[model samples]
Target: MVEADASAPCTDPDIGNVAQARRRTRGPSLDKTAQTRQQIAEAALAEFVEVGVARCTMDRIARRAQVAKGTLYLYYPSKDELLRGVVEHALRHSAVYTALQRKKGETVRAFLRRSLLPTMDAVENSERGLLARLVLSEASHAPELARLYKELAFDAWQTYVQDLLTLAVKEGELKTRSVSRSAQLLASPFWMALVHNSLLAPDAPQKLALKPLVELLIDNLFSRSAGDNANVKSQ
Candidate 1:
């Protein structure tokens, strides 16, 4: 005890405890950061839906998220950025945005029908529908929101459908003079149904049915042999 060795490892409990606390308080892990970002995006979406985007504010979104105002800004610097983030977050969970692989020997049309129909049928009643409605309702007033929605959602779907149509053409399942136009045609029914059911006739006695309309469009777009058409009709 006369003198402590200079090279000896530190045995101070206080020092060790302080080091451990520092490590713990260094920062949130990557997962925690992602979770927080998602929380903010969801909160923003809720605010935008409850109060139109034009009326929505960062303070409200931060309060809704239970995050500090600075925290919200850290994740999304501006309202337009937040809008983009919210749309991206929503699309991440949408089955329509999921990249599905066609089964071996499955035609592109069949693959699209099988993959998209169920999701499309339920989309009108989901958060996605609400987001679409928000975009449409605010488009005239909030041009930025409209631009983000068009760039992120509309163009994305158009590109995805165009790719499928291109594949169908290669597989001899479809013959179209313009895949781009065909893609637009294929996706038009969903928007029509969405508008009719939500904006035009939310309280209508008979809501538009999306599944049959999409199925009919698919059948019309894809070239099927007489037997295949008969088989589809029989089913």
Candidate 2:
């Protein structure tokens, strides 16, 4: 028999104990970092919403957060990165992701569209419109921010579309299609509608117009199944 090793019997409980100890050791640092980031994001949101991204500055953000300018820099190196941080924080905390993750047995299209309505509502509300305007206007100036926005919105949207399309195929409402293509097919029209509303109709941005679209999208896009085909209610 091989000689026994002292650490060999550490096993699952020992390993878990070690992991918990490590987490405890790291917890303080992680919490502090998160709080700092939150402070920066809160400040950035106030600054961006009031001034628009073009007019917002790191100095203003620092003063608003009550953090030193150097502290803000510790979290985000540049203005664009700060903008991305703020947007990401807002979207991440919004009900959208919660709606997506907690949903079960709901068609992907139904759940995501339902989740998206909150975002649309946020974008459309006059009080909240400044973030949307800055997103469209100032995004062009910052390529990183643009990419972050796209990644934040589009990638998640695409992933959800892929799942919905797969379910749609089962329902026979959607034709058998590549998941990638399906993702694109489902994502474009909604975004197109968003852009149209945001850019054109005076009240469109404010109203969101999500209720009708949710119904229409299901009716037109899915192949339809016998079960729950009449009304695709995410609720």
TM-score of each: 0.82, 0.63
Which digits, one per residue and each the tens of the lDDT, describe model 2 over residues 110-193?
A: 565676556544554532344545567667765666677677766776776576667666655455446577567544554555
Best prediction by lDDT: 1
lDDT of 1 by residue, 1-235 (tens): 2122223221322333323433767856778888988999989888888777767777778889999766677677667778888888887767887778777767677788988898789888776777888887888988988888888889989999898888767755567788999889877888999899989999999989999999998887775433443333221
Model 2 Cα displacement at 136 (Å)? 1.3
RMSD of each: 13.4, 13.9
lDDT of 2: 0.60
Task: Evaluate residue 232 in candidate 2 and report its C-alpha lDDT on the 0 to 100 scale.
Answer: 48
Task: State which candidate has the highest TM-score.
Answer: 1
